[model samples]
Target: MNTRAGEAEAVDLQVQGRVAWRHAIRSLLAQPRGSIRMYSPDYADWGLGAPDVIAGLDAWAIGRSQTSVRMLGQRFEGLQRDDPRFVQWRIRFAHVIACHALPEECGGLQECLLLPEIGLLVIPSEKSRLAIYCSGARLHAAVHAFDQSWEHSTPMFPAHTLGL
Candidate 1:
C-alpha cells in the first residue's frame, strides 16, 4: 500500500463499492493544504454532493485564505437537482471554488481528484464504484493532464444565476 519513488513517498489504495469510494475521497480531501482539482463526467454518482462531504469541503475552504478548489466535468446539467447541498456549498464558497465544463473538442477525460501540493491523486470509476488512491511521482502525469483539460474548459455551474 506504500511505496517510495525517488524522494517522494507514495501510497496506493484500491477501493470498491460506493461506501469505500466515499471514504477514500474523504481521506484525500483531508490531506490537501493548498489546492484541489477534480474531474468527472457529471459527478452524479460520486457522492460529492452528500451533506458530510459538503461540510468537509466547507471546512477545507476555510482552513486557509489561499486555498482553491477547481472542478471540471463534461456536463453538470442535473447537479442543481441532484446535489442541492453541493450547490449551496458552492454558492457559499464561490470565491474559493470554481466549476468548469470540458469542451467537446477535449474528448474523453478520466475522472480524478488531484492535490498537486500534497502529491495525491484519486481516480474513480462511477459505474463500478471503484477508486484508486495514489500519491508521489504518479501524480505528475495526472496533474499535467488535468491542467491541460482545465485550460480548455469553460466556466460552468455558477454560484448564482441572474434572473430578470
Candidate 2:
C-alpha cells in the first residue's frame, strides 16, 4: 500500500512470509499503550504454530498497562482444552486478551493491527505474503475501521471468566 501521509515513506521495504509475520507481531508488541485487534480462522492456532510469537505477546501483556488484544475469528473451543500456551495465557493475562466471533460475511482479516500510531495489514497469496504498515493520516482510518468492527463483536470467553 502507498504511504499517502508520508508515514512509512522512509522505509520502502516489505517483508514476506514468516519473516514478515514475525516483524508484524514484534511491531504490535512494541506499542506501549495500544490495542491489538486481529482476525483469523482460528486465533488459537497461532499459539500452537508460533511459539516465539505467543511468548512475545505474553511478555507484552505482562509489561503493558491498559491495553487490549482482541482476536476476532471463528469460535476456538480448543483454546481451553488443546492449546496449552493459550491456556496458560488465559490463566494469567485473560484480562488483556479477548477472543471475539467474526461474522460469517466478514470471514476473517488476512491479518491486521490497528494501533494508535500505526496500522498493519498482512496480505497473502498462494506463494508469498505482503505486509503493509501505515502511519500518519491513513493510520487514523484504519483505527476507525477497527473500532467499528470491535463494536459488533462478542466475547469468545464467557462473561464470568472475563476478569475485566
Model 1 TM-score, all chains together = 0.83
Candidate 1 weakest lDDT stretch, 10 residues: 117-126
lDDT of 1 by residue, 40-92 (tens): 77776567776667767877787455528889987887777888878888888
Judged by TM-score, which candidate is best?
Answer: 1
Q: Candidates' TM-scores?
A: 0.83, 0.67
Question: What is the per-residue lDDT of model 2 for residues 1-164, given as tens digits with 9 covering 90 to 100?
Answer: 45556345423346577665655656565433467766655543244324665666676688655538776666667655666665666557767777777676754445566666666666666787666776665566656666677677776754245365
lDDT of 2: 0.61
Return the TM-score for candidate 2, rounded to 2 decimals. 0.67
CA lDDT, every prediction?
A: 0.74, 0.61
